[model samples]
Target: MPRLSGCAFFSDKIMQAKVDLLHTGAEAMFADLGHFSKKAIQIAFLSSIYPSLVLTYAGQTAYLINNVNDFSDGFYKFIPRPVYWPMFVIATLAAIVASQSLISATFSVIKQSVVLDYFPRVKVVHTSHQKEGEVYSPEINYILMVLCVGVILGFGGGKEIGNAFGVVVIMVMLITTIMLTLVMIIIWRTPPVFVGMFFIPFVIMEGSYVSAVFTKIPEGGWLPFAVSMILALIMFVWYYGRQRKIEYEMANKITMERLGQLLAMPEVQRVPGLCFFYSNIQDGLTPILGHYIKNMSSLHTVTIFVTLRYLLVSKVDQRERVLIKRLGPRGVYQCTVQYGYADNLSLKGGDDLVAQVMRCLKRHIAMSTDRRSSVSTEEEIANLEAASLAGVVHVRGKMRFYVGDDAGCFDKVMLRSYEFLHSICRSALPALGMPLQQRVEIGMLYKV
Candidate 1:
């Protein structure tokens, strides 16, 4: 949707309309309308109702030869071959471009959904050097190609394709209409009478179209339903399965007070430099950290507990980018990095993200050491430079899942699909834009 880019156009709607239409044939019509309200209604009618009426009339009067017949070959048969061939090439190119846009948009939504923890991840490779979100997915590209082939082979002709396309568009409209009605009551809290006035008729209109679309299922309409259902199942399984994993982690999570007490032990040696522990468990001690301590018997001089949190926003400002909370003593700190829906954590200048966290850590250390004193900007920058020179490393646990014999059918199915999809997705390490040598992965097993 152009909702993110249409702010200026919507802000000065009247001016926009004038510039687009005042010098054209609509200028005389606008003049005859006189007032803005009348002109607005006239423009809306011209754009929507008038066009539909004109199209219907044109189709009947110019193209239709009979009252009951609808044929896919009719239009091409009527047109001269010379004119038909030229127009066909042009339309084909336009359709190809339109299909490109649709596929890109779908992949964009899926990529963002993965970041938002609503879907399983896919391999997203940047195709554009200058644009942050210009990504290409091999998996999606091949899948779309196969589907396109299937569609071409399955459809009898343009009629079936048009039928399928119209059905999808109508179904989309119906879904949006229902969502708008809920938004009116839940988001805007609009009065029920007013909500009914705006939404009811539109919903009824779209619902009817959708009901009609359902009638075509026996005639090439079942493909979209099958595809959508399968995709929806995959998405639902990934989201709720991950949610269960998070719940499991939280249920067995070690509290901060206990973590601090463990760190305070005399035998816990502090090694030099920063060790970045990438974790999903935000507040508690992660199994990754527990496993590290159990094996190494020593801690880093500076421990950065990094948690990448994606916000519901499209883009976040640097001011609200990172939240650093110092947990008790022994160089332990939690650095929560916030990213927006459109943000690329692995893009160019990603080093600045880690540097920002380092700067925050330095500032926290200075403030805590002084008790009542504060860290100056100069001192913080100096500390960051120092820490950068010493060294920094990222540590993350790669979890392997298991369901016991007692697990029910639903649990087994969900977890099996979750692991299968998880294997295909790019793990957080490679997706994080960190140097390969600096990133360390430890294997972890979680039983459900």
Candidate 2:
């Protein structure tokens, strides 16, 4: 039961993952196309095909004199040699296509999880410049390859893998049903009676699949559980440690007066071009900015502290996605970009983030009535254009953990585990879609 406890991962692990409305709709449309297309095919022609296939299978089962139990053998017995061979070939092609779809879905789902911050940063390479969605993750790919090799070694045949796959498919369906019921009662406010009407049959159907596959745990069914548990452990540990770090940052951040002093300091000279100080913190400057001004000894002409947050809804309106607030007169701004779990970030399709930030800041400047009326619209645009020509840079703080000097034994152990897990997690740079040359990463060590 403890090992099987990984069943919880199917839902809980994906809780942080965003499911955008457009992607959801596309998936649903394709699902419907598959479902009704099959239904239509059955109704129009497969009705006859089904009866014949059933008879063929039944006849093979009935024949005690049957030389073989294999489907190809069965087909050879019932159908013409040439026709049976082609049928087998066609079936194989169909299976490969189906498997390709599954593989593609796996990549997309994991990428989505990374976006939603469920997983740590991983290398995501766009395989096609023209096709925005065509991406490849080497880390996930290698992990999958190893797992598949292990599965082939353990299962020894496609039939065993397929049997386990059937169990997983049913389990996912059951989980989807359970989640749907909750969504109905909560989000959609469906009546209890209607919820019961929708889920009862599925519960029975999927529960039967559970029974069928539960016994096969010893027969390679435990593969997914093992894999999921390992993945879930890595995911949760990274997320928990990162959350703790952010909490630390929030609790110990510089006060408003202190931040004002730092920004207005004589050493904080405004250089040409723009700088993006990326942080999860919404209030008070991230400690890294303090480090930057002290160590780097200067600030950008335009410094916008950008924080990306996930909103509760499915998608934020394009106009409302980026919220801009000018913090002080030191060319500092706070830009919080909100994205729904299911919504794509504004930086999608190779959009220039620096340009977007400038636009948001311009909009803010235009709306503010308290600003001096001396600077006209043309001048404001010219300043932005000048900065755009000067180029842009992204700055992020990378934190490492150490046990606190006054820490207890438990704290030391916990900090050790945290650092170990954190080390294995992906770096933020690759995930942020920032070019290596333009990105500046500042390191900070936290005694936890």
Among these predictions, the greatest lDDT belongs to 1
Q: What is every candidate's alpha-carbon RMSD to the true fold? A: 10.8, 9.4
Residue 375 displacement in candidate 2 (angstroms): 9.3
Q: Tell me the tens digit of each residue's lDDT in model 1 across 269-336.
A: 87766788888887686865766776777777767788888665666777678788776654567888
Candidate 2 error regions (>4 Å): 1-80, 123-139, 197-201, 264-274, 294-301, 308-323, 336-352, 355-367, 372-393, 405-438
| lDDT by residue (tens digit), candidate 2, 271-390 | 888788888778787876777777877878777888877554555777888888767554667898876544544333545555566777787777776654466766765776676679
Q: Model 2 reaches what TM-score against the true structure?
A: 0.69
Error of 1 at 342 (Å): 7.2
For each candidate, give its TM-score against the true structure.
0.75, 0.69
Residue 42 lDDT (model 2) = 49
The local lDDT score (0 to 100) that residue 124 gets in candidate 2 is: 65
Error of 2 at 233 (Å): 1.5
* CA displacement after TM-score superposition, residue 6 of candidate 2 (Å): 31
